[model samples]
Target: MERTERFCRIEMLIRSRGCVSFADLMTELGVSRATLKRDLDHLRTRMDAAIVYDRDRNGYRFAVTGRQARRPGPPEASGVWFSEREIHALLTMHQLLDGLGVGSSMGRHLQPVLERLQGMLGTSDSEARELVRRLRVVPPARKPVRGRSFERLAGAVLERRRLRLTIEADDGSGERDRIISPLRMIHDGGIWLLDAWCHESEALCRIPVPQVRAVQTLELRAREVPMRVIEAELDAMPALRAA
Candidate 1:
């Protein structure tokens, strides 16, 4: 694999596991000891990653959190570099998600990863958070979207596949599952809604991201909806035209 890809995997692995052994990283990345050490050293010294080797654990961990410091814009990029701007963007994103009361998947899983990345941008997590809070978004409704649900929806839309959604029904019916052919995602203020072809309803409907409890991927062989059909159905929705 390319060096950048390897670096990402390393970050992801370490983030998910809290630590990873040298042998485990080597086996997973399929790289020599020298290449691994070089990448780790570059991340620590150049990118200012807090990856530290714990002799007791015999692995690496980011080892820090909290935000406090002015974040400069990214410097010129060459390779394997994450800019301060990117970090700030994520900081802002997490802030928004928090206001929206997005669900546990993003709150529990993704936030720490972003927090760690923010900490890597040469600031405490709190400082990175301060940078995000500097710009405020008006308060948003609490919809409880799963952490990874938004990302999975985007992937489903890009791949033109069906998404199985566990969402709240609008009619006081509480939650139910709907298989949908997702076409578009609309961001209204701090809210995210999906426009899709609902198999159960046999029509287009708005699926709120925050209301989504889970998103499941389908097999490749599952029947896929044509984008043209989705567009046509979307065009026919009176609410869409009214907007």
Candidate 2:
């Protein structure tokens, strides 16, 4: 993994696990003790990550109460924020987006906002343009079900609401009406899946959006579905199971 990826992973680990010992970090990262110590020092000095020694825990911990002081602020607001490595990572993401063919649309719509970000880093427009050209990103394939239907189903799933769906055959033969409680939306192998709970079956199901002919929101509330059960069903799917 790249240094930036490692740093991001370390930050996430700290946030999720609270205090982390040197030995623990070494074990998790498979890095030498000296390397882990250097990374810790780099985070403290460059990223403003507050790592304090906890004698009782026998590890390094981020003091939650004083976190604000240690966290780097927005660049323009606080010129002292973000080290060179952080800036490089940010630029890399922009470059990746550019390479993905979405950059033209993003430049037309989101470039203005990104201009402010560039200003914070003291990077000129020409420099940003150059960076975009030099870096490349390959985006994954587009999924089925574009436009309004996709948006509606996504919203319903996010809000944890029930949806009245009509699944129609491609041959225009039959339709099935279902009241489904949306659980999760998964994008896999260039396909979008709405993992939901079918009230009629009292079981979890995966609905491909393209097969859904019509979708409408229902006043009926969503019911809690066990994540493990839903995951098991998903794993049992022929395509996923084959993989």
Candidate 3:
């Protein structure tokens, strides 16, 4: 198994058992003693695991307030810690993805990554939901969008694919079809926009999500854009542009 998978298993084992012996971890994970020790060290130092070895108990466990005095393990090492504000930010993002319509392909693409972050934060979806309730985000001045329209744009962006988008026009004008190589998906001022290379225009453009009436992802492979170009375009956006 991969290192990340091993890390998840280790966390589950220790959390479920309250304490776990190195020998037990080796047996369960089928990893050598050195690897197990390194994993434990990494978890405690990098991931904010409240863990310590207990000499008398001959195992590792989460540190408790009074238990530390009697257990007598090594001093907890200092490392990066997640602040409450950071957690709140993560939870807010969790809320955004969770609110997407069910069975969305883009949501599926993101689930694994989101799950790992949730595990690292030691938070559940229910907890995130409660947090979302407490801190509300009211979108301002955004036109309502059809659910399917949002899904198509998101799926295309996540998959790094081109899309055939039907752009609607005003003054009773008919819609026009354009094939775009999606570079990024962004939200601003309560509206969703896609930064893409338009085949019709032969230039980079930002398409408003609400104005997209229909979308279809092409089977053809997506054209790759350079990292420098994407970064330059992102920096040139109105929000990031220097006055």
Candidate 4:
């Protein structure tokens, strides 16, 4: 089993059985003596898990509870513990969200999740913050989009609702309104494109999200299109071609 799985299993076994023998842990984890020992040490030192060997029972159990409840020990870690590899994965997620423009628009909504993961890491908050600060992601030049428009359009697509869009004419002729059924929102080459079925043209069209001057969600239900057809339309779009 994977290291993370083993860690979880070890905790579960200890919690369920009150105490678990070294041999039992090895058997349950399908690991060698040395590996089990390393895992226990990592749980104690790195994860701040208050696990202690019970000499009387000849087994291991949580120091915070069980028969030794009265005995004083180090405080148990408050939240879930993440392995080193998991910490790296969380850092990658943080960077990706910033790159995708979600941080500025949706940061407040997602801050709690981020904080929970950050707190669960096996490092101090300052260290985690320092690591995130050191690894900078410089995204390519991206077109600016109004957060409200993006949010409303995204909701309309998920809700299967139609939209009334005021799109800026390509030739500087001004804006025109089009009623469209949004199919999907595609982000490619630092631009957001709305894939929708145009009611006026009776065809699938890709609209640059930044070029949308105004947006309004309609009460009417959106028309559905097959996934294969959407893929074909996306393949033919000029924005998706090789630059």
Candidate 5:
């Protein structure tokens, strides 16, 4: 696992198990003794974690007191903890959003959040800027979009609204209109897809964004399906005939 994932996993293991032995941590993380020691040291020193070696139990555990400094609001609200690679991934996603042409207003809104992320990696503004400048994300060429439905579809998905769509049949059949509840939008294999609950067929369907000829957002709220149900359906038939 990557160091970021390992760090999160370590925190979870410690919290859930109360005290995790070195051998157990090593087995769970699948790292050598030296590497695990280094990770623990980094967590305690760099991350300001309240990890303490428990001699009584011969394991590591979070300190009972004085582990975390008193801060305003809840812990989730106050902290933005992330590793260097995760920050780079976020920056890359930011670039992807910019490339999607919705970045004008959104970028302005997200700029401060990105800056905060950068702050976690550096001590000063200049250092953060310098660190961010070192990484560049180059997105691959995507399939040419056929119509203006991309923006409307994205908005509908975010707003949890129903949609009236005119999609070109993949089998060379003419356009078909359908009412669907937008569940999620996915970008896969350089093409965008809308996964939704089709009202006509009463099933989940995938619609290629490029195949979308027309889109109309409805005022009615979209149907909500549990993620587990979606995953189960997806697993049963990896490929569902598109709408």
Candidate 6:
């Protein structure tokens, strides 16, 4: 990757991970320690972002509230706002969920905002209801997992890093620390699966999120695994295929 791309990625990683160590950044970006350190210095000094070390965690993170402060704010209304088509699509999705009788916490939060958006567009409540009633989404049956861990796992995958997790089976007989390079998250058979590369097995694995006892991000970086190859491998897995 180019230096510029590396720098941009480092910045995004810091934002996503809340704080990253020189070693972690180097591993993730496939750059030298010196280069990663320089990038960190640039962010701290030039960008006026507070990046600090945590003794307990032995990692770098934002000084303010660590990872919590990195959460994105609400979208601003000005400049290249969502088009009418996009708004309609969003409403349609919400309606489909309503039809499925699946109440989402996110949807609950978005309801008021969606209503306000419709009002701004001068769309009547009956019309919005009708649109939602017409739209349908056949969501696969998947057991709900802890939302927070799912979010963290997503961050790890996007940053191309490894994760250390304790997985427990449904019968409550299995628990082990797994080092996985997460590729994507999928909901199937009413459970969320973290499609990943199991470092111990040196092969692809799909771990149920609900069965995950605890999650810890690893310092080891993820190798570039093609999505198509991962999908093909996943398709061949009897467990995944059945699910």
Which structure among the candidates has the greatest TM-score? 4
Which candidate model has the greater lDDT, 4 or 6? 4
| lDDT of prediction 4 | 0.77
Sorted by lDDT (best first), the order is: 4, 5, 3, 1, 2, 6
Please write out the lDDT profile of model 5 over residues 1-243, one tens digit for every residue.
777667778888887787899999999999999999988887776566678899999998877543243543222212345787778888777767755544453655688788666544534567766665665545467666654566678789889999999888888679999999988887666677788899999998888787888888888999998879876775366564575
| Residue 212 local lDDT, model 4 | 85
Q: lDDT tens digits, residues 1-243, model 2? A: 555455656666666676778788888888887888777776666555666778999877666554465666421111233445666677787676555333454455556556545544445579867765666665577544734566678678778789898886546688979898988877666566778888888777787766787888998778888888878778578853110
* Best model number under lDDT: 4
> Relative to the true structure, how large is the alpha-carbon lDDT of every model?
0.68, 0.67, 0.68, 0.77, 0.75, 0.66
Q: Which stretches of candidate 2 lie over 4 Å from their true place?
A: 1-142, 170-176, 239-243
Alpha carbon deviation, residue 59, candidate 4 (Å): 17
TM-score of each: 0.49, 0.47, 0.50, 0.62, 0.49, 0.52
The local lDDT score (0 to 100) that residue 140 gets in candidate 4 is 75
3 against 5, candidate with superior TM-score: 3
By lDDT, the better pick of 2 and 4 is 4
**Would you list the clashing residue pairs of candidate 4?**
none
Clashing pairs in 3: none
Error of 5 at 242 (Å): 1.5
